[model samples]
Target chain A: MRSKVWVGMVLLMVALLMISGCAKKAVRTDGDVSQAGQDAAALEAEKARRAAEIEAARLAAERDAKRLAEEARLREARNQFMNEHIYFEFDSAALTPTAVSVLKEKGAWLDKERAVNVLIEGHCDERGTNEYNLALGERRAQSAKAFLVDMGISPSRLSTVSYGEERPLDPGQNEAAWAKNRRAQFVVE
Target chain B: MNFSDNFLGGRVRRWRRGFLVLGSLLALAVAVCPSASAADYGYIDLTNPYLRKIPLAIPDFKSVSGDPATVELAREGARLASQTLDFTGYFSIINPGAFLVDPKTMGVTETDVDFKAWTGIGSELLITGLASLSGGVVDLELRLFDTVKQERLLGKRYTARQADLPRLIRRFCSEVLMLLTGNPGPFESQIVFVSGGNGQKEIYTCDFDGGNPQAFTRHGNISLAPSWSTDGLWISYTSYQRGRPDLYIRHRLENRGAVVAEKGINLNGQWVPGRFELAATLSFSGDEEIYLLSGGGKIIKRLTQQPDIDVSPTFSPDGGRMAFVSKRSGSPQIYVMDMGSGHTERLTFEGPYNTQPSWSPKGGRIAYTAMEKNRIDIRMIEIETRRIVQLTQGSGDNESPSWSPDGSLIAFSSTREGPSRIYVMTSFGTDQRRLLSLPGAQSQPDWSPNGIQ
Candidate 1:
């Protein structure tokens, strides 16, 4: 019976030791899981920072592209407005009916764009003397300017210049080319 | 004739004695025969084109200093003299290869000339020259002789720097022409015109024979309508240098130029004869009109008050009247306005497009370019009778007719060869030839009035 009692006490001690070992392993495992969770949270925060940087860079690139597109569009619009010129007959400063119609369009545009100033350049064909052409070109420019002023455009916002036969849009010595060169061009300042 | 004989030296006097003896015999023979007296003096008709050209012999010039460089220059001088005379279309040069006398052994003095040899080669005139170089100066002595009469026509000596050789030659040629035609040659003058390509036009001046072309204005802009002052010391032209059509006068010898007129559209300024006043087209009054401006760019007076385009004013030789283009008749036409009375008269009525009227120096006619059959041609009209004469026809678009200083030839621009280039022709449209073969197209040639003395 006494031996039986000692054996029971030894078995109880072994049980206590086994239970303590299990409790310690459980505590260590819980600490390891909490550390792993903190590491994963740090990794997640780093990923969020990287994603934010990428998003910012993309937005900036998109804004630059959009700005350049807008600038090109404005430039093209200005060119289109200036491309329309008023033409005249050979050695005549009288504005044709078609030329007056075109000038009306230009006048309307000038009315809307009040801040824009322009120069009216008069040109002539190579048919006459350079000096005479210069005088004729001046008359053509003045004629155009007068029509624009008559159409309610401010004369101060418009200036006149005569290029004469010095500058020709077509350098060919032909009737068709001369008809193209005899024109009044518009330049935005 | 007797004065020239007295100017002869010793050996020349000896030859003159022999010539006099022969001349006396011929005179005696002519006195006996009435028909022989008709051939005594050789007179060339200036208006006759069917006459034979005077044959001239120009031997190699002698180098008095015996220097190699002087020798080369002497030969060149002789060659240039021959070329100058040949270009006048009044003389035919006798080839040196056909010479019977040795040029080296022949002395430059008139007595040393073998008149028989020159006469044998069908030369009516003989030229002998002597050149010497000393201290960077070249001295030349030239003499012209009538081979048939054995008389010295001209004797002159010129001394200048070696660089002035061409001028010396031209002066001698002018003297020769004066002796022949009673009018001094225009070879010493210059021509100013517009020349450019690739959208850059500039004013250029060249020798009358199209030698030594130089750009006078490098404004990097349009410069045109160059006109010379009566003295040729200044050139007035229209320039866009300051971004407007204005007038500028360039002092050719001083190498400086200034804007003379900056008022609105100061284009085509022409100098009035014997005056510092300029007649130019100005648009300051909101219309093209002619105005008189002083040399200082001051507006002296307004010449035209027409409500149409009036430009390209050219003064008469007397400065009493002005001929210009006016569009008051619904088309460009030539008009004349008396400067004193301001009474204007229409001068052109035939051509629909008559412009660039250049008043002749003779004050009898006005030459201009007219449009005909869809092509431009040069034509002239008499100021008094209104008789029209077509100076150029079937040539590619001839325009801008300018008269020579002597009014014997017309210098105009034509596109006959390809590009518009300066051309020259007689008053009757003969001997049409290109004036310049420059790299770019040249136009609007205005001959200088005369050599700047």
Candidate 2:
């Protein structure tokens, strides 16, 4: 009887040990799968972060390029306006046809911009009396102002003044200087 | 008590005392005198060529009404004339009470009046007048007599409102000066000067008396040396508007202008007569030289042979001769040249520097700036005799003397006020006054032609 009882106890102990070993293997497998799932989630999150960073950089570059292009266009327009001068005829307060054309083009540009206030400066050649020349200069400025107003620019936006014989475009006493002096200059304020 | 006898007795006593005092003083001074028989005439020796004053007598004009108000008006007119002449620094008006003749007794038509009376009173010139209120206006008849010459020099009738008596008196006095000195008066001329407003020197026009000034050039550019055209229609000036010194002409009536010349320094331009020629200083030849240009901006001839500085040319009334300042003689001096022959003659001596020669309209003399003995002054040179009469003295750099149309006075620029201001004085260097009291520095005063009515 005692021998049979010992055999039963040993068999029970062996069965219980095998069952605990299987449970341990199942728990180890569950931990490894959970850790692998966490690693995969971290990798996918890193990929999404990198994609978002690239997209932000690309948008910033596009915005910078757009701003530079706009600035370039503005610079070109300003340069064109700055380089053009209004010329006049000899001893004439009246504007020449070419001066009228240039003024028209400038007026169109100003129309597009609408916020620009210009100063019309009347100049004269160094050949007349100072008092009389001043009066002539005022007429030249008025001539330019009249044209600008006719082209739809508001009269208040234009200011006319005579430099008289004070300001000359050329310092020579030759025809070249008189030609340069007979002009109305447009300046952006 | 007899009041008249008592007053007479008192006056006799005072006179006796005054005579005793005067006698003793005279005796004491005569003991030390260089001559024992020196007369007691109150006269000052004018040994210096630059005399402080030439004694003159301008008495109250005899009024017809003899009313106190009329008398006062006549006295005021005479006083105005005296002040005007005195301001010219050439005349020292003697008081009538200091002499024997009463100013009330003198008349403008009394040509037989004793010049000995004025000479006895040590007056070199005697001016007398009569004023009458007729037709609701003041009619004044003035007479100027050279007591030394013993002849009447000026006689004129002027009619003006009673209120304008002061100005009329000044104008009449200036005319008298022209008759005596042979130069035009600057009283009625105009000057164009530059003033700083809004950070730029703008051109402004004012009367030679510094009245009725108006701003003409408003462009914010540096204005310099605004010269008048002979016709008074245009002004040629150099402006920095184009970033270089360019020549420009401003027309009078149209308020329009044009560039006359360019590409170098074109400056100091004066219009030649008939609106056909312009004389200007051009630096196009790498240095400043006088160039003659057609009215339409074509170079006709070069006035100066050397590339030295030759500027500020003023033509005679007939345009036959031009007076210019040249630096060829190692210093700036006035030179007169025949416009047709180009024959140059030096007109100034006794000064290291002389510039800004202005030919008198009558062609008798040239007015210019002269530096003498470390002092800059205005001097007039007789064209034929080369006699230089210094018109100004002291430590002021009086420059740019412009002759009046009638050759009586000169309008000039001086830097006595820390900045340049225009001044008018007699050709004798008297009666200087500040004209055109505008803000900023005003200089380069050019008198206009006769704008008289």
DockQ, per model, reads: 0.35, 0.04
DockQ of candidate 2 relative to the true structure: 0.04
- In angstroms, how far off is B48's CA in candidate 1? 5.1
Taking the tens digit of each residue's C-alpha lDDT, what string does model 1 give over B78-151? 99999877766556789999998877678556677888888998989899988899877888888878888777
lDDT of 2 by residue, B147-247 (tens): 77675655667778787786677677666655544333555556776676333676677765677788767667776667667776666666655644456
Worst 10 residues of 2 chain B by lDDT: B1-10
Clashes of each: 0, 56
Cα distance off (Å), candidate 2, residue B24: 44
Docking class of 2: incorrect
> Model 1 segments beyond 4 Å from truth?
A1-77, B1-52, B64-67, B106-112, B134-136, B255-263
How many clashes does the backbone of model 1 have? Answer: 0
Say which candidate scores most in DockQ: 1
